[model samples]
Target: MRALTYHGAKDLRIDTVPDPVIEQPDDIVLRVTATAICGSDLHIYRGKIPMVDDGDVLGHEFMGVVEEVGAGVRDIRKGDRVVVPFTISCGECFFCRLQQYACCETTNDGRGAILNRKAITPPAALFGYSGLYGGVPGGQAELVRVPKANVGPLVVPGSLGDEQVLFLSDILPTGYQAALNAEVGEGSTVAIFGAGPVGMMAAACCRMLGAERILMVDQYRYRLDFAVQAYGVEEINFEECDDPAELIIERTGYRGVDASIEAVGFEAKGSVTETVLTAAKLEGSSGKALRQCIAATRRGGMVSVAGVYAGFIHAFMFGDAFDKGLTFRMGQTHVQRYMVELLQFIEDGRLVPDAIISHRMKLADAPRGYEIFEEKQEDCRKVVLTP
Candidate 1:
């Protein structure tokens, strides 16, 4: 099978690898029909994510037809088309019982113990993320072994194409969860940083949930313009301003937005000090986006983060967040908890996840796809690959 593998920083390749088989009682072998290169994959591509070795299969947003099912798999069967959630969880765990699938305790293989030292339990294992998350072979290949099949793979109707349903595996649910955490609702005001795919999805969701004013911030003119055209959001080009938060606050009548979301994660553009600190290994992530979120949010409002951050930030503005009584909510998306409802949204035409796709290529062309996406070539927004 040919799949995309991580070689090193800015290196990805299509390699012929051994096919996967059923490895557990609840596992199913899927023949991947469609897969996508997520923005988070860039972390691994840039060698920022630790523990990813050479030839590690790399992708999380994928959907396919079940080619074979283990004896214990009940709800899903052979030939069923399904979208697999990135988070692999055992449905019987305490967190799973509470619908917090991302916190499932039984799936991490003790690799998460390192984070336990910091009083933060590592999240559930994710497909193709890294050894930190179980290092499961991802679905970027022609075939993939999907564990916890009964729990994580949501069956999709034949009426919807793979493009329409693939994002259920990750970003669509992630963006939806971000909006929910920020309490977006009728007449709400929101400021979202990052106009990438996830940011665009969040804007669409905020509008669907009845947000009257949505402010989108990013350095890319094309992305910001797309957000305005697609979701009717107000655009803020951070590159054009001295401080984007100050601009957001001033534009919002000095009250700031009701909710501020940071969709750009650890790799967000930062100041010289933050870059130096990160390069020196003193900071785990850039606090630039979070700082903007805090400074642009109204007092007692919510600051929701859907972005991925694996470590500590230097000079975090926790004091200001405390002083403002701002509520903070962030985490890996519990994709299983929201997949079914969001699928309904897609089926009803309330959410058009595929509308953001700007490029489509064969699985063999994934290296080029990654290059264009990372370099923002051809005004790329999202890239989908067919195996």
Candidate 2:
């Protein structure tokens, strides 16, 4: 079987690996039809994510046909096409019962003790993320073993192509959750940092939830322009502005936006001090985007983060957030909790996630795909690979 594997920083290769088999009663072996390189995958590609070893299969956004199913697996059967959620969860856990699938306690195998020691009980095990999140073999392959199969794989209608339904695995639901957490609604004003795929999806969802004004901030002119053309969002190129938060505040009549979202995560570009600190391991992540979010949000408003942050950050501006009475919401997406409803949104044509895909390549060409995406070459927004 051919699958994408991580060799080291900026090194990804399509390797022929052993095929997967059902390893648990509830497991299913899927023949991957389509898979995508997520922005999060870039974390691993850059060696920023700990515990990703050489040859670890890498990818989470994937959908495929059930080639085989374990005896205990029900609801999904052979030949059924399904989109597997990136967050693997046991539906019987306490958090799962609360519909917080990302917090499922039984799937992580307790290997996240490093993170657990930091008072953060690691959440769900994710496909191909890292040892910190359960070093499960991921789906960027010809075949993948999907655990918690009955709970995670959502069966989609044959009428929908893999491209249309693939993002149910991660970014779509993530953006939706970000919007929900930000309390976006009719006539709401929102500012989103980062014009990447997740940011664009957040803008689409905010618009759907009836936000009247959406401001998208990014350093990339192409990405910002795409957001404006696709979602009718107001674009602010931070590279051109002295201070994006100040610009946002001025645009909103000095009240700031009703809510702000940070979609760029730990690797966000920041000041020279922050960059040096992050590179030297003095800070866990750059707090630049979050700072902008806090500064651009109105008093008593919400600051929602869909971005991934791993460890402690230097000078996080907690005092500012406190003084403004801001509400903060962030975490991994409980993908199972929202997949069905978001699928309906896709079916109804209310969300067009695939519209953001700027490149498509064969699975064999994934190394090139990763290069272009990581480097932002050829105006890349999203890349979908077919196996």
Lowest lDDT sum, 10 consecutive residues, model 2, at 110-119
Q: Per-residue alpha-carbon lDDT of model 1 for 1-387, expressed as tens digits? A: 989998999888999999999988999999999999999998888889988889999999999999999999999989999999999999998999999999998888646524436655666999998898998899899999999998999999999999999999999999999999999999999999999889988998999999999999999999998899999999989889879899889999999999998999999999899999999988889999999999999999999999988567877799999999999999999999999999999999999989999999999999999999999999999999998
Each prediction's whole-model lDDT (CA):
0.92, 0.92
Query: Which ten-residue region of model 1 has the weakest summed lDDT?
Result: 110-119
Pairs clashing within candidate 2: none
TM-score of each: 0.98, 0.98
lDDT of 2 by residue, 73-171 (tens): 989989999999999999997899999999988899645624336655667899998887789999888899999898999999999999999999999
Instruction: Go through the candidates in order and give the C-alpha RMSD of each one to the true structure.
Output: 1.2, 1.2
The segments of candidate 1 whose C-alpha lies over 4 angstroms from its true place after superposition are 113-121
Cα RMSD of predicted structure 2: 1.2
What's the count of clashing pairs in each model shown?
A: 0, 0
